[model samples]
Target chain A: MRSRSAWTIFWRTVLGRAYPRIIGAQREKSWVFFEIFLPLLQVTAYVYIYRAIEAPPEFIGFVVLGGAMSAYWLNVLWSMASQLYWEKETGNLELYIVAPTSRMAILLGMALGGMFATTLRAIAVITIGMLLFHVSMTVRNVPVLLGVFLTTLVALYGLGMLLSSLFLLFGREAWHLSNLLQEPVSLVSGFYFPVRALGQVVAAAASILPITLGLDAMRQLLFPAMLGDLRFLPAEVELGILAGLAVLFLILARRALAYFETLARREGRLSIRGQ
Target chain B: MRANGSRSEALRSLRVAAWLGWQIESNWADPFVFAIYSLVKPLAGALILVFMYAVIAKGGLQSPLFPGVFVGNALFIYVPAVLAGISWTIIDDREHYGMLKYVYTAPVNVLTYLVGRGVAKTMVATIAVVMMLLLGTLALGVPIRFGGIDWPLVLGSAMLAFFGILLGGVTLVTARHNYGVGEAVAGGLYLLCGVVFPLDTLPSWLSSIGRAIPITYWVEAMRRALLGERTALFSGLSNGALVAILAGSTVVLAVLAVLVFRLAERRARAKGLLDMQMMY
Candidate 1:
């Protein structure tokens, strides 16, 4: 009975949060339009820029894929990771802590909700890119591509959950910290370009992000001509690493949440607005 | 009698607003982090584009256009940082701090107060621009050949560009207050501003939109001033004529911003939206 109830509660949490977000976003028609379409313009600029310099046709597909994946990273940074900051500011964190449900459930809801939102936007971006730029993406193996994509999402969201716990310890500075993550991550992760183009040290640093490995794997798998057989590791090995990181982070996040909650309670820090 | 009293009051309010704006902007991050943060985004962008160009171009970094790309990316930082900073001031104060109603009720004119904030924000932006330029020239070895450059014209063009951005920011904030779409407007400007590549090479409609913006002229003028003989845009015009065109566009944008702000104010008052709670 207890096991059954836990499963029920988990699905309830995920669906409850995800449904409202989709509805709330849809209520603001303009928000939906801008969020979906604005990214395309940015992608278009980079594509045009690459063309102006006369990069190969495959590089355009590389850019499109990177741009699509970047939506999830932005969602992780701005929405999932920063959700704790929003909850604290609005006095929802106390209610969440007081509830009987696990805090992991809340983060799970965020990860799932963010994934849903970003997937819709990313699909639109990919479709428009394929249509507009005539980007040719031939998947060598469907199962491998799907596995890498799902594993990337899991690893990325795990990182988001970890960040949520860390950001809970912050006050208004969370805003600045979130802003600080954007462009540097774009550079380090090689969002619009290949990581190999960056040097060895930077490539080593990029491996700390699972998205980087996932991107390399996807590129090599999809467009072997453009990227060549230059991955730092094999595809299955990268996928294994990503899966391991996701599980490790989810476990660490739960423990960190408990510790931070106790610290906030004992130190009387949770409700303090802006330090 | 009353007119003189109001004018003096407005002047005093402007001074205080400018001071407060600077403090609010700087106090969030410590000095070191703020300096690093300013350098990181613009420099990273420059690095990415330069690396890509080096990979694709025939002569790689030896290409004649390499320095232009470096300088252009550095200047592009102004659009994101300054433009966002200016819009956020009003949005933050009114929405986040819940002080818009109180500020409006004060004896100070809203336009004057906004202009005061713009001055402080512009000062910070100017520092970022200079820092990016220095880092590009010194650390990155982006050859910024300074000989035969018309210094006065460049400075005048930069000043005009800054003013245009400030006024454009005012128009954006007012529109956000009315339309409730901040990110869309900011994103559109970043993409449409000819930041990364030349506007001429963009699609015809996009290029037309770019020509309508003041930043396009400023960018062209700056490039012409920096790379004197290589400019295709101003081959027919003298440096004096270029400066005149820039100044003309700046004044037009400033005037339009003031008009839009007044309209926004009237709309907000009519709808009783000035005191609405900020949505997350």
Candidate 2:
């Protein structure tokens, strides 16, 4: 009975926290428009570049898929990982740390809220790309695509939660750490082109990033015509690897919480604002 | 300490502000991290464009158009560094440090003070610019012919471009102080300025907006002046015409930004909104 009540309390805390954030995101109408439109403009630039050099017609869809997937990664870095930094600045981290609830509950709230908000922008980008650029997508299996995408998000968010602890421990001057993630991740993940387009050594190095595997699997499943030229593993193998990574990162995040708390307590770094 | 401020005294204050700006930016990180941090972003950006060129052309950096991508992305480093140093630095001062009121109340004119701050930012950005140029030539093997250089034209075009960025930064920072969202404007400029692709391919309505932005002409003119190659995306105009257009735009925009900033300062102070703007 006690365990049941604890589980119930945990979920209630998460949903209660996430509700206002999701609502607040909608309240800022201009930010919502900017979020959707800015990414589409970025994708449009790549599409036009491809047009100039006469890349394969299907590369348009590839670029669109890559752009949409990358929005989730951005959310992870900004809304999930850097969230602890903002909370520290805003004085909420202190209250949460003193509270009785599990730390993962707070991150769970962030992940759900961020994913909810980012999905809207991602969907808008996809729809706009289809209408404006006429990107060709041929889904072979709906269930498989859904599975791969969800698994990828799970792994990505787990990594984000792990990063949160690191950021929390580092405090304010470490914003460069998050900035370090963006462009390198985009480049390594092959956001506009396939990883194999890079040489073998680089491709092997890039495969370490789960998003690269995720994107390749997604493109292969959604556009089966590209399957003949698949650079990474098959969809099932990629999805399985992503699932494994999800578990691995979640375990690491749990360990990171303890490690970060000890470090923060020793260094007296908790809730140090604007360092 | 006279009631009437002398021109020399104001200039001294401006010089101090510029020095302080440079010091604060440099001290943000340790020297080692700062150097590595500076190189990573621009190099990664160049790699992205290089990868795209290779994929589309079916030959790695062997494409006829690779030189354009190489130089374009290298020069694109100045956009974010300069724009952020101007607008976001002000936003940070007012919002994070709560220093804007004191800055405004200082004896130095705000326009002169901002121009001084801009000079400091440009100095830091030039380091990154030179690094990018070296990375492109030495590491990436981008074909920049030394013999074809137009030294005077390049210098003239560069000055106007920097001036245009300064005016845009002033306008953006003024808006930021009043209502917030300076970062979004900076990000929007990165996309709209014809940095990587040509503005001509955009829809006519969007291209019209591009036509008004001075950075469009600046990037085009810089490419033509430095490389002696016409832009494949936009701006077929002669270098002289491009420089003339950018200079005129800078004068008009600088005057407009000054007026707007003055009005915004008055209104913000009147309504007691200086501190309140940070809540966003």
Interface C-alpha root-mean-square deviation, candidates in order: 2.8, 3.1
Writing each residue's lDDT as its tens digit, candidate 1 over A140-219 gives 88999899999999989988888888888877667777877777777788777777778778877787787888887888
Tell me the deviation in Å of residue B170 in model 2. Answer: 8.7
Native-to-model Cα distance after best TM-score fit, residue B90 in candidate 1, in Å: 2.3
Model 1 TM-score relative to the real fold: 0.91
Docking class of 2: acceptable
Residues A1-275, model 2: lDDT tens digits: 98988898789878866775588877877678767766776788788778767788788888898888888888888777888887787678889889877788878887888878888889999999988898878888999999998888888888888888888876545566777788888888888887767766876677666788889899898776568764566889888889998999889988898799778978888868777
The number of the candidate with the highest DockQ is 1
True contacts kept of 2: 0.48
The DockQ values of the predictions, listed in order, are 0.53, 0.49
Query: How high is the DockQ of candidate 1?
Result: 0.53
Clash pairs of candidate 1? none
Query: Tens digit of lDDT per residue, candidate 1, span B1-280?
Result: 9999989887887798889888776777799877776567656766777767766766776666566666766665555544555556666776667787888898887666766776676667667777777776777676665676666556544443344344444443353433324345545655665656655667789878877776666666676666554345446777787678777776775676666667767777887767765456
